[model samples]
Target: MLLNDRVCVITGAASARGIGKATARLFATYGARIAVLDLDAGQAEEAARDIGPGHIGLACNVTDRAACDRAAEEIVARLGRIDVLVNNAGITQPLKIMEIAPENYDAVTDVNLRGTLYMSQAVIPGMRGQGSGAIVCMSSVSAQRGGGIFGGPHYSAAKGGVLGLAKAMARELGPDGIRVNSVTPGLIQTDITGGKLTPELKVEIAKGIPLGRLGVADDVAKACLFLASDLSAYITGAVIDVNGGMLI
Candidate 1:
């Protein structure tokens, strides 16, 4: 019960096997009244119901500033205050550097980077009001390694920007009692990447990882839990790599 009665809002949390949803489920077990946010209202609400009563789901297009603002307002009005904000709404595309078009760049960067900015903006006021909060941004190993199996150059650039944003926000918000951090996960078996990685491919990828297996959603979720909870009370402006030693 590390997060007992905490009001946590997580974006892009409705997916069946996504890291966001995994985090939501794990957080709920620890006594958080969760706000599961997604682009689809029905899915978001359903995801909340699956967690149990008292928690709620919200429809939020992280790319839309107005939508993000509205969602934040409703959560505050209903849930009372925002204690944790997980900027997890993101998308990736596979394309080479030359293959990246203006629209491709916009689609990837807008969700991964712009959405992070907007959602954090939407919650900072409440966190400031409470004089305490935790904001966890979802970056990727792709950002650190310069390329990934699925993400294009644009994706790497977007996530790298996320790291910079989180560090800057952590510095600016530390005095306000807000801690900001980033989680960079490697080859997690989620809905987003599952469709692309075949059994044979997964085995091949696992061989490179020192853990001898590909990462699961919960691996990243556990890292997020540490960052979100008091376990990391003094930790901020940092990046936790849940890459199973892929980088090393």
Candidate 2:
């Protein structure tokens, strides 16, 4: 077990078909105690229960600093220590530049960028004390290629900020033995894309992808498992691409 006896927290993990939930299940299977944090308290707890025993679920709005702090403290109090954190809580909107109102931009950027910062801030103190930890922030291919099928300019901007933020955090946190990294995932078949794409559109998209298929939630989850585990111990300040050659 790569994460034997470790405690892990994943944000926005309540959705049944989301990447965060997949990551929680994978980590649990690897012997890690998982905590599923989401905006809905009931859903969070339910998701945790679904994952298995000895895991927890909590309500956390990551854009709120106090909420992030409280959730972090609660997890530590319940689980003993936090060895890994996956900042997977995020939201996106598909709007053109002109369609991006202040509210839309705020909704997208606050959840994706501000949430990542707040959650990381909340976890760093505990990690510093332990002198060993890992944080994986979820960026998007939209950030790299400038736009995506579903995310707008604002979403791309937010994820671009994630890449930079993770790198900077990795540099500063390395001295404390806390590794930080980002994962840039391409178009994955999740609730979001499922709602946005037709079967015919998905086929067309797959043709454009070198792997000839859209990524699945498990594909991104496994990449995150690598970064959170000792297999990538020497890696930090790096961005792992889970795009299945779409960007190459």
Candidate 3:
């Protein structure tokens, strides 16, 4: 158990088929106490129950700094100290730039970019006080290759910002024994994409990937666990690609 006895906080963990939920489950399996944060209080609580005891669920609007701070405080109160922070709360809007609405763009940026910043900021104090911690931000292959398959321009831009933020935070926090990194996943099959992908579209995407398949939530979660563990102690400001050779 690489994360044995550690406490990990994962945002956007309520959805049954979300990457955040998979990451939370993986962290729990590795013996970490989890704090599952999501916008839906009931769903978050249900997720916590599914993960079994010794875990907690909290309602948090990651876009709101005050709410994020409160959630972090609540987690600390229950779990003692936070050892890992995963900024995984995000959303996507699939529309062409010309057709995209201002509200859609704002919504995507608010959750994907601003939300990541708020969550990271809220947890930095606790991690700094502990003298050691890891932070993982969820970027996307769309950020690197410009959203050929997944999200719209705004979504790609926001995810790109997440990568940049992770790198900057890594440099600033490294001396304090806190490491920051980002993971970019490619064409992952989650509830977010299920509604958008037709049978023909899924086949088209699979053919483009060298691995011959779309990515699963576990693929990203495994990469996250690696970054969260001491195995990555010397690594910071690094972007791990969990894209199954889609970008290569």
Q: How far off is residue 200 in model 3, in Å?
A: 2.6
Model 1 weakest 10-residue run by lDDT: 190-199
- For residues 25-134, what per-residue lDDT tens digits would candidate 1 score against the true structure? 99999999999999999999999999899889999999999999999999999999999999999999989999999999999999999999999999999899989999
> What's the C-alpha lDDT at position 39 in model 3?
95
CA deviation > 4 Å runs, candidate 2 = none
TM-scores, all candidates, are 0.99, 0.99, 0.98
lDDT of 1 at 220: 91
Please list all clashing residue pairs in model 3, or write none if there are none: none
lDDT digits (tens) for residues 40-116 of candidate 2: 99999999999999999999999999999999999999999899999999888888999999999999999999999
Q: Is candidate 2 or candidate 3 better by TM-score?
A: 2
- Local accuracy by lDDT, each model: 0.96, 0.96, 0.93
